[model samples]
Target chain A: MDNMEDNIKCVTCTAPVNIAVIKYWGKRDEELVLPVNSSVSVTLDQAQLRAKTTVMASPSFPNDRMWLNGKEQSMDSKRIQNLLNEIKQWRKEKHNGDTCTDGLLMWKVHICSENNFPTAAGLASSAAGYACLAYSLAKLYNVEGDLSAIARRGSGSACRSMYGGFVEWDMGSQEDGSDSVSRQIASENHWPELRVLLLVVSDQQKSMGSTEGMQATLKTSQLMDRRIQCVPESVEKIKEAILKKDFKTFAEITMKDSNQFHAVCLDSCPPIFYLTDVSKQIIQLVHAFNSSCGITKVAYTFDAGPNACLYLLEEDVGRVLSLICHFFPPDKDDLNTFVQGLQTPSISPLKVLLWT
Target chain B: MDNMEDNIKCVTCTAPVNIAVIKYWGKRDEELVLPVNSSVSVTLDQAQLRAKTTVMASPSFPNDRMWLNGKEQSMDSKRIQNLLNEIKQWRKEKHNGDTCTDGLLMWKVHICSENNFPTAAGLASSAAGYACLAYSLAKLYNVEGDLSAIARRGSGSACRSMYGGFVEWDMGSQEDGSDSVSRQIASENHWPELRVLLLVVSDQQKSMGSTEGMQATLKTSQLMDRRIQCVPESVEKIKEAILKKDFKTFAEITMKDSNQFHAVCLDSCPPIFYLTDVSKQIIQLVHAFNSSCGITKVAYTFDAGPNACLYLLEEDVGRVLSLICHFFPPDKDDLNTFVQGLQTPSISPLKVLLWT
Candidate 1:
């Protein structure tokens, strides 16, 4: 047998970020991390926006240690503690009377995580980071029951990042929140023609975190309470729109829900304003662009920050992209690098040439 | 006797502008110009923002002729027609059994109107214009049942401008809207210490007029439906706050209602954005200023335009003014002209010197 230090068992995993089509704004239970309404999201390609995590366990380690990016973080965060405790309990139950393979369950764990995209740019970096951590640690400790539910313990939205394509998180009714989980609505290949474009309006960290912001909304906004009441029906409609692969209904629902989320934000006491001037201009531009086409060819959704995530069909992507560049021209040197992510390198400049 | 043309009957009146603290957004009856919810407003002094109207009826005039400011305008506008028709009908009833002083009531009317402030700047120039028109026309025709009711037919908000100081426009339950009218809540001297500061963020015409904007909101925003349902209760609280001279409660209600108005704008389909970067900066500045003081000494509200109207006490005016000038310094040449309206010419630079 190898030494305990030499027996450093490790597992690595990568998870993609997700953008909500129907947003989750308020929560019913802060302790259980239960949402007031269900939400739907699309997982970006891991190659474009992803978080990579590695977990190593060894008997020689004194305690659990975690590093985000290159810097070490405190293991005392309650969210991290919840995820760890839940996973350990699952492991104990899975092998109640059976022999374990590597004795990794009892070993102290060390976790490291990093994201390719800008963190806290309203790109859901936390979701990907927490999802990757849960995936990697579960693989390392051989804990396998309801991974999404375990990820939800870390970040409410993290559960949705566990799957690709369209996914919806049901804001479960159970008092224990045992039923609150993310389920895949469609596979990545279900709508191959669809494309997403993120406009990084700003890289600044948000003044208010989503958790604190939602708490304020839940407490103060009467409109938020009303919004939550209508969301259950909206969730069903959105699911149907996704299954039908109907872009019009999907785009309308996505844009309307985004607007309503921001509306509730504004209604929140001491109101949270997430959309900046650039964000408003983008919204107007999209409306104008759709009006010109006489159909909804594109849709935009903003999270808790100013960045705009636009969705469009593959055929219309070039046209809308060209229009965006024209309306919001980048600085001379920044033109070439104006856009980033999966479509940038693959789509030829020739495609935009015709649009210009 | 004078020549027939010299026998022209004329009357002129000036009306003060009104700023809605509890905004009236949607119209229940477009033809009647009836609001879906009640609203309250503070009537500004005519020395600052006012509309002056002169109506002359002469048998020599072939048809109704109208002039806005100095330019001749078509008399075909339905809003203008509504005001004229209502005033004339009132005249016929008042003198049906008595001999009229002159046959001026049978003559075609020639009207001239002008506003001290910029029209379509969300300063409610139309409210003042219609109020002045209704007032002047009533004086000429010697007809009086309810001038505000006739003004409401011209512009829904104009009804609020008919009264001085604090005014409330009741969204009457009557089907004919005969009961819908403006009533004075308090006299102009009720709170003499209260002062208003208008920051002219922009004088540009709004992309969507309030009428069209509200139509969109009523048609599309479900949040707006819920908002209207709560307005009757809000109106009562606002009335109580005003009567009690409770600045804290008054300011909180004003700020929250303003934010809710804009929130519904965002919830509208294809969303209407009325606030600009400057408007947002002003909001944040006001919040920061209030937070520093540990009390709500000042309150800011925005209409459809980007301009911000701040309310504060006379004692706190100088310090707040200095702070505003510091954060939003005008060009050196514009410093003298920074503050507009009634307070501009009367208040010397010496007043601001006390704080600076």
Candidate 2:
């Protein structure tokens, strides 16, 4: 109970979740979002693309109000509503200030959310948005549990979003999922020089959503068992590769995992076709470009859609970026703006200007 | 020792090779056509579909002549021709006959070859044709060296065609390719009741040739190395699965290997795009159909193109055929004699009765 106008404060927080080259496939418990094995992912920077969430609570308001990506949504959904109720209950029990009236039964909450990038794209905007919403609410409500544990409820991959760096979600054996949580493997500060070049190929929504596709794969794919068993080993290798900054090992592991994930997609009962011609072309061109330049290890990963996210070493960033730009040359009208936007203080100003 | 007509007879033979569920990706040596690891394959029945070759020689003819398919060809362009010459020379020397001076050298050989099925439609027609051609020639010329060894020089897979059943190509480490030969894993008589349904999704030639694609993959894909290294283990598993007649293990290994092969195709520098929507649909339908029926396994393999070759358990053969026919209904209007001519005997009798 609360007269929340005086006690509650609206706070906005945002974050971005990364894709796992070593994908998470089977679940130990579907309801709990507990995976069959541990999985690792790299957290992307939140400067240009992220999920923005604003959480507001007040006694003056009538009921919980929610907006997801600018559209009004029902708080009636069991999952979202349950989380909201839990947070409200926590806030009421914790607050002892006079700002909370003794007779107050509820505090109305309004949450607004949006993403800087397209939600329809296979770029996993929902993963980032849901993870951000959970993290932001946890901070606003002063929730006590571990961030990863709370985020896990939001989405399976959301657990990895709690940390702002490389993270690993360990699919623990506890039946209650109490031990299934993410741990920070490496921080962004540790890899400050690393850069990711995102090639936004298609912004259209995927035909089969990840959850549905994964469920289908578990049911139909004969290969799913092997893949599930293989993930733990892949996770370990990826962790070691990232820690050592071994781009060769990292690239190899990442590419193999991505292919394996897509293989599982193909292995799904009534196989899910995700990668389109454009997606395939991007893969082809990336390899060709890398080989042509004698670059042994630049990593490219694709999600459920056609977009490509290329990870490049700091020293080779400029050359790789230039080659990418030249190969995937933007529309004449957008070229100048595209080139200018990629400019950073540390990059050669002359080179950036030359592109323009 | 001077009479040549008694020593040589005109004979032609043809065979079809099966694509492995576990693919052979890289070569140990291009010159020797030696694979980095052992590979397993199924041999399609000759009566249903195979390569057709005709070999003819006469004293009236001039020079040893060779024709491939329908066109006149030069022996110089083909490596197999040189190998044939070596065999002929050996036969002459072994017999201690002046057959070369008895107008036998003046007698020419005319050879014509054709495939009942689509060429390069993921069917391994070339392997069969070359193998049969070489085998038939060995018989015609009475070449003395091992037939398997001679077939190996024609095509890496041709050696498998020398036998009439399941064969495994031993990827020996010997640089001379002396030990790299094929051996029968199982005879057709061992699984006499088993049947294979070949779904000709498209008869069109593949856009990307396997040889060119393999070369590209070897030059660029990082996954190629891993694939080559990993195939030996899969081969062992597949062999054991086959020997045990374990359909579940067999199907699982086959599907996983096919997916991995295509994954390598995607991982290639230029990316080899082989499957079509129809091919993907077939894969999906097979998965869904099998899963819905609670059948854990049914094997399907694709080669360089979209056509699907499904290996059904003898018990499920009728059900699968009916299902496939129902889903991919044949166009009655487009049913010409050529299409009608190729129908399986089991289906042909029913079609004839229905038409009458």
Candidate 3:
């Protein structure tokens, strides 16, 4: 303990992305990052898509510093500062030691975070990044408690990423947002046969970042209130489907929620369009494929960007992927390409022939 | 009447297209063509876009026949039959002094209808076509009170085109659609300075015709109920805007209703996409242009097709058109070109400079 300059405690943690089956669109409380309604999501494996964070605390450090995906990010944003300050306060309160002076609690920290996947459009990188940051910092300080609320302060969906597997962020009725915390509905291994495929396409139009976009929708979208009313019941139904392992019901609800979320985005005053023609083709292909199968075999959802996240069962994956490949036939191996033209990769002819 | 082949009565009438500032999306009565809510529209001059119909009744005609845009069309659809049958019934009922055998009522009619505008995407060609058919048939039979209700039998929006200038399709509470009819809000000369530019975009995806699209929305969209509750009030506000010549309010409501209509379309099960990336660019351009002016100088609306119908004052038309031309310049004089790439014609740079 005498060599205080050498006292460096470091922790590295990784967190995965969560695709919302029941989406969180508008926020009732902007500063607290509370959603308008409860939402259900499926967390992907960290190896598939994730944010890895390394948090280091030392007496030698001068001040709090942070880096995101290599470049230094501003620590001045109100939300980021609120998160950092809250963690610092929690470190002191959460420690159960009786030491006269816990000098490490006052020490500044250096944080570095990066995402492994490059195709990051609407992949909820912020959710993974924030959850990783909170988890790493909590480990570094030897703190144990619910970190979901801390993650929620960073991004509304980040709270759902705090747990591994099926999760839900209940939009609690409270003035202080204390009850608005995420809970694990089921474990990652509960529905082992389910899978999600992410198709990433770069966007030419830089959309209004989620923060401003949510605010705009809250103010302008006429359908926002209706969506808010509908989602709580939807969350319950999604939970029931998840527990029953009803892929059909789960898939149907997920696609509907995604469509409704974007619906209101278009309903906004100036309007917002996240789905590119390619994203739309993927959508059309999924519906046509499902219709041809005579049952819901596959489902698709899109976040704030053009990338499409598709969900399907293990049994149907091979045929659905084959169908997607035959129609969409990637121009590149990595699946990152700039799409052009309205030439609908018409799947009607193949729809009846291929899915069998 | 002995030489009945030569004793033929003929009538030719023309009708203009109407742009719905307040849109009607859902049908409370699908067969009766009764809308879920009231809607208001602005009728364009027939000189700009119109449907000309020629109706002739003669004993030489063996059977009832119809031709649309020079091509033969089946007279079998229930909606078309209902419209034709209603006119015949009205003709027999309204003849002030008639012998038992009117003779002309039994004679089969040959109908021909055509639209002048080639850029018919989302331009409400069906509205003009149906309105013209109703008007011509009414004139041929010398039976005239209000033909809007009869036009409603063919297409929901067709009733709105029965009047010139601002018109309102009051969705009356009647099980039989007896009270549901279009009414004139203001004459064609009410707002002389107002102008609309039809930016026709050919769609690669054949959308569900409005009838089917409306049914799908009524069945699937959660926003449809909210929209139904909202438009009756919107109809009042739009009428007020037209009466006062408040271009700002009128433009704002028109854009909102258009956005909402497309919103519900996107929210439908399996979803429906009417706006192409090119269509979305024009939307962005309109919003950006209006934002730059700091006063609502322009507005845009889209129906079931990718084409954009922009509304602006006569004084502002040149600037808006020039801005559109510079960015989305026509590759050909006629301006029908296949678009490619996600190249967002970014107007932010020119938004400030050109509008000044």
Candidate 4:
């Protein structure tokens, strides 16, 4: 939807979700959404999980309005306000007298965003949502070049979703978070053998949002101090692993960092628990599965929820999926929609004794 | 029983369980069961949970034999063998000419032990068992003085169980762990206002024993290095809190240390999870209850198992217990034994909005 009307302008964009392999937890700068440490993320396929948004600017509107997944959501949040103001200001300054869309810059805007997947069950819906919002607004106002930094003002991890495939959020030294933008290290086509399986364990909204949870961890967890120092080195290692296509090294670091991130969550005062018994069982299954295979055939990373995001090679996907099906059989009625993602070659269910 | 018949002398002793608030997780010396850092523990009332051990020495006995819960247990474990050898050696050295008891030291011994509560479910059963064994054997051989250090050889936490109330296991600088003995900070009578409620959530034998679990955390968890440095200062703060009878400070430290210990477990590679959903729910309940009351009324700590050991003041015990019972109802058949500990003053359950 790129057509421009007489007094109103509209643009629609879609952004995919990304799971941080080396996570971004606590924030050094709250307003700017700057991270305490650099992080690495892998963008998921948009076909399975994404946020579709349409931004319309019109002289007829009174003020900024937002509608999320059909329901109207307040745009009064400081994060959202700052994001919209910053983008509009950037457009007004950068494209002062553009012939076609100049009048639309001063006009009020309405944002309608919807996620194909669940919203706040920690599937990184906000990342996709904010990235989509930023991308659409930028495109509508004729703002070109990298908008990752602008996208990050809405959500810290949102910046990573701005790029496809593997991305890195550099924890910039600037207090204003100018260098905290995420850039793609490799496109989706770089790793042809890589495959992912998104296991939707729970669709229920998370009890504590990431922002509040991060604050709790930062204040209460003494271990977080060490984690801050511990992350940068791993970011480099995972990057190297990503480029070399070293699945074993990548898998090892991914699982370790995810566990470490949650460990910090649990270490917080009034400890934040995002993982359920099913999440833990999935973890045990992965370890046992790897031990049984005599190699790291699969790796699992969880976000701020119980759902499990498994990454593995294409060849191993069949055997692993069969093992998963053998253990966690789909509900009788919802069997067709159970394993939703990029299609994997179907193989007969395998007998796996991988209980640890 | 304390009796001497024929050429046999027997002594029975009981020891109460202790829950470490500071936590004794990793060991600097595995063989000696020496901890990497100092810890503080509170001994629970023996009436609620205890291990009774009977040690007998007889010239007719061919070798040392042991029975646990009516089942014969091999004395092949190094910890048992080392404990027995050390005690006999000490007895032979100190009581060479103690006429009646002197001859008993030359004979082989038969040891039988049993715990009133579940074993290997993180109830500190091992602490009670080892303490009881050391006490009864010491009595049989007429070996006097503190057996806390000797008990430590069997299990690191056993040293703390030798005391009646609040105890501290100092992480002695000596490599031999000679100075790492536990001492009573305050007796059970010191805080008559203190009360405890033990929730036996799960008696399932833990997948990983504390010894092996500690090793894994020590090796893989980077945060553990920071935790080692962070604990000693809190140990001092908690000790001060205990001496001052400052429930708030003591409660805060107790809960923080418990969370940190479990956090390290989660941080480990192929992470270990001791707290179940029930345990986590209990944690949330405690926090919510404290917030609702505008004070820290209760503090909960978990060992390697999912069971919750809640510490609160005697005045607040009824309210807290009622809250616990409200959230967690007992099975019809097991209703009578649901809340087991020192008898609390019965009061009406107060209406509480503690679901956080």
Please tell me which predicted candidate would have the highest TM-score against the true structure. Answer: 4
Reproduced native contacts, each prediction:
0.79, 0.15, 0.89, 0.96
Candidate 3 backbone collisions, by pair: none
TM-scores, one per candidate: 0.93, 0.69, 0.91, 0.94
Best by DockQ: 4
Across residues A1-356, which tens digit of lDDT does each residue of candidate 3 receive?
11223688888889988888888887888888888888888898776578999888898889878898888877777877777767766766766534424777778888899997653444568899889888887777677777888889888899999988899988888888888999999999898878776666553444778888888999998888998888888888889999999989999999999999999999998898888888898999999998998999888988888878888876776576567668766555434332211122333222111110
Given candidate 1, what's the lDDT at residue A168?
95
Ranking by lDDT: 4, 1, 3, 2
CA lDDT, every model vs. true structure = 0.84, 0.68, 0.80, 0.85
Off by over 4 Å in 4: A95-102, A118-122, A347-356, B95-105, B118-122, B347-356
- RMSD (CA, Å), candidate 1 to true, equals 3.9
Displacement of the residue B350 alpha carbon in candidate 4, Å:
16
C-alpha-based local distance difference test score of model 3 = 0.80
lDDT by residue for model 1 over A60-141, one digit each (tens)?
Answer: 8999999998899999999999988888777777786345443777789898998876574456688998898888878876
lDDT of 2 at B28: 70
